[model samples]
Target: MTHHASDIPDSFLAKWQTTTNVLAGIFDVPAGLIMRVLPGQIEVLVSSHSEGNPYEADEKAQLNTGLYCETVMATRALLHVPHALEDTHWEHNPDVALNMVSYLGVPLLWPDKEVFGTICVLDSKKRNYQDKYVELLWEIKKSIERDFVVIEQQRQLLENNAELQAALQRLTALQDELLRSEKLAALGAVVAGISHELNTPIGNSLLAASTLQCHAADFAVDMKQGLTRSRMLDFVSTVEQGAGILMRSLDQAAKLVGSFKQVVDDQSAADRRRFDLGEMVRSVLSELNHTIQGSGHRVHCAIAPGILLDSYPQQLAQVMTHLVSNAVQHAFLPGVAGTVRIAAQPDSEGQVVLTVRDDGLGIPQANLGRVFDPFFTTRLGRGGSGLGLHIVYKLVTAALHGSVEASSEPGQGACFTVVLPLSAPAPLQKPEVRAVRNGNFV
Candidate 1:
């Protein structure tokens, strides 16, 4: 909070000294000085040399009633006396004792309005300082203040950089935690769906087995009472019916288990291999069949077969699953019949465009843009975690090195198009340079 002119750097002192030399030469004064305000004294930080120059650099003077600098500091104004001996009030000033009777000075101020000192010139003979001289001194003072401005700016910049770094650190930690929470939530939802789907088929198979056991006991009793031809025929028909039910139930259970296992395995595995895009899409549909089972919505795929990719198939599978699931949950109203169509093809640019479109109550025009933003959902309190589209966006961009966008019109339908390369770009590496011994380096 407390600043003295002595606190100025040596570089600034050197510059001020050069300025004082120029000022004195222009004004043809015997001495020019840059004085600094200390606790109780005015100290000369720089002095200009001319013939008969009585003041030297680093000379100290008291700021009492008799000195011209004292008057400038007291009023915070310029003090100009053509000749101290001619002015009745300044005839006995301390400078008069050194035979320097003329004086011109202006008060210097720090950025905070605190007194720094005075910039002044003195003459051994009677001489007046012109307006041009005063103007020149003002310019020199401005140069010194400019340096102070730079110092303050650098200080604030350092402080702001520290705050920015701290904020970035906090954001990184939150992002990690959010990623963990989203994974757990997605896993929980998948497990619940798989459980629900397996329950029906397995439960039906158990019921049919119980019934078959009861029928067998009834036949044993009828045999002990001496079996009839009609009874025997009826028992054979009943046995055939029960066996058919058991077979269908068990078969359904096995198919559900296989589909669920395949989806879970693909999502967890990150292996990259050659795969057919059309087949991959159909596999994803099988896994999501349970989601749209009774929702009156059907998924149709028109992927170009033999369109192979050497990318992360599992991640692509997850992307397809989310796209279809989003359509089932958000594109249609309850009990409404609609069709979700997925089409994939290679474009002229060697990029594959996969589009998932729906014919249902489409998204509102206003919400189309924000649908991919994290935690942005119209069904917040319902079953929406609001992370599905956000996850899709990230996977397509970061993991797949692709881009995705959505377009929708209310009541017309919504479509999400993902554009990806058949193979991601290779990572950058430093180039190798070989020296050729023949004639020149290559």
Candidate 2:
């Protein structure tokens, strides 16, 4: 509807003008018009003719008027004719009698659930207003519907974006909570292992102390009165036993503490170092021997003997340990054990390929993309924090300057390949940093 073009946006009013010109060419008609029907008036939104269109702007065609748009709106019916002048009920209007004759008009529904206007094509001479012409008007109505669908789609997309943002915030909160829970679980495992390590030495020391005290007192009494061979022998034996117990306890304590220190140092923020990759794998396997065996799993370590890397050894070990542990716990379906393969190979360009694969039921394709996402875990309750793979990815990409890729097919298996430098080759260490441009996706 329009009084002056300035009332609506220039772009909006201009759009209808273009539509009228384009539709006139496509329909092969003298004129094409779009009208907005109001409470007591009809307004022309479009009129393509340069000489001024026969369809008037702001002229209300009264209910019983013979004009096509007015009569069609009044009766809520379609009106099409070969010649408006020949139709007894329609040629009464001066506009039709003067020159405009053939006509086709159809309702332009408000798609917003309100009734709005009519879309029509007009010709000045007698022409065939066949059923195909009526069908042509219906097609134009559909094009109008297409525009409304686009608007509705954009509205729904914005609403979905809002919902997704809320979901992402909730996921971040859950990740913090999971980190706390993981810390506690790891702490408990450390405490349990330490207790077992300390018990064996402490118990032996207690027995040795008791025996040494009893034997020394007897030996001292015997020496004060008169020397005795049997008593001296007993004193020597007690001293030897006590010495062995003290040495054993010291040795066990030192080894346990050393391992704990190594774990801590590996995670420290320090310059990278070169280390033997093969030895690292062996050491991790030895430490987790009981766990592997208890779960009916075997450790297979064949890491090419002397492959070296200029990265943190302890961190790499942690990643491998977590992966192997994940395989043991979650690789297979319930009540089944699967072989977990771990291999490392070097290429010509000083790049190292480390592949870890499992012969167990694989991840679903829809979920494969999300597996490495922080806090995403298929095994939720059965001891999975979902951060192991996330940590692995971070270490490989930033710390080691490497790339990781994963592939899988349902019911087949999953494989994760990590490609890194054979040797960072004396390069200076640098901190990881990133810059954002138009959007911050990462």
Candidate 2 TM-score, C-alpha based = 0.43
User: All models: lDDT?
Assistant: 0.76, 0.67
What lDDT score is found at residue 211 in candidate 2? 72
Error in Å for residue 204 of model 1: 15
Residue 151 local lDDT, model 1 = 57
The lowest-lDDT stretch of 10 consecutive residues in candidate 2 is 433-442
Tens digits of per-residue lDDT, candidate 2, 191-218, equal 5545665666677777777777877887
Model 1 stretches with alpha carbons more than 4 Å out: 1-22, 36-38, 43-68, 75-102, 106-116, 124-271, 286-294, 334-336, 345-350, 364-412, 424-442
Displacement of the residue 87 alpha carbon in candidate 1, Å: 11
Q: What are the candidates' C-alpha RMSDs?
A: 10.8, 10.7
TM-score of each: 0.54, 0.43
Instruction: Name the runs in model 2 displaced over 4 angstroms.
Output: 1-17, 22-108, 115-143, 149-183, 199-229, 266-346, 351-422, 430-442
Cα lDDT tens digits for candidate 1, 1-442 = 2444436667777887788888789889888888887777878888986677888887898767478888888898888899888889999989999998998888877777777778888988888767887888788777766766765576569789999999999999999788667646644664565566567778888888898899899999989999999999998998899889889988977865654343222132237678889999999888888887867788999897998887778778878988898888888877678899999889888789999999988888887876775445676445454556766766576556688999987667889999999986542321111101110111
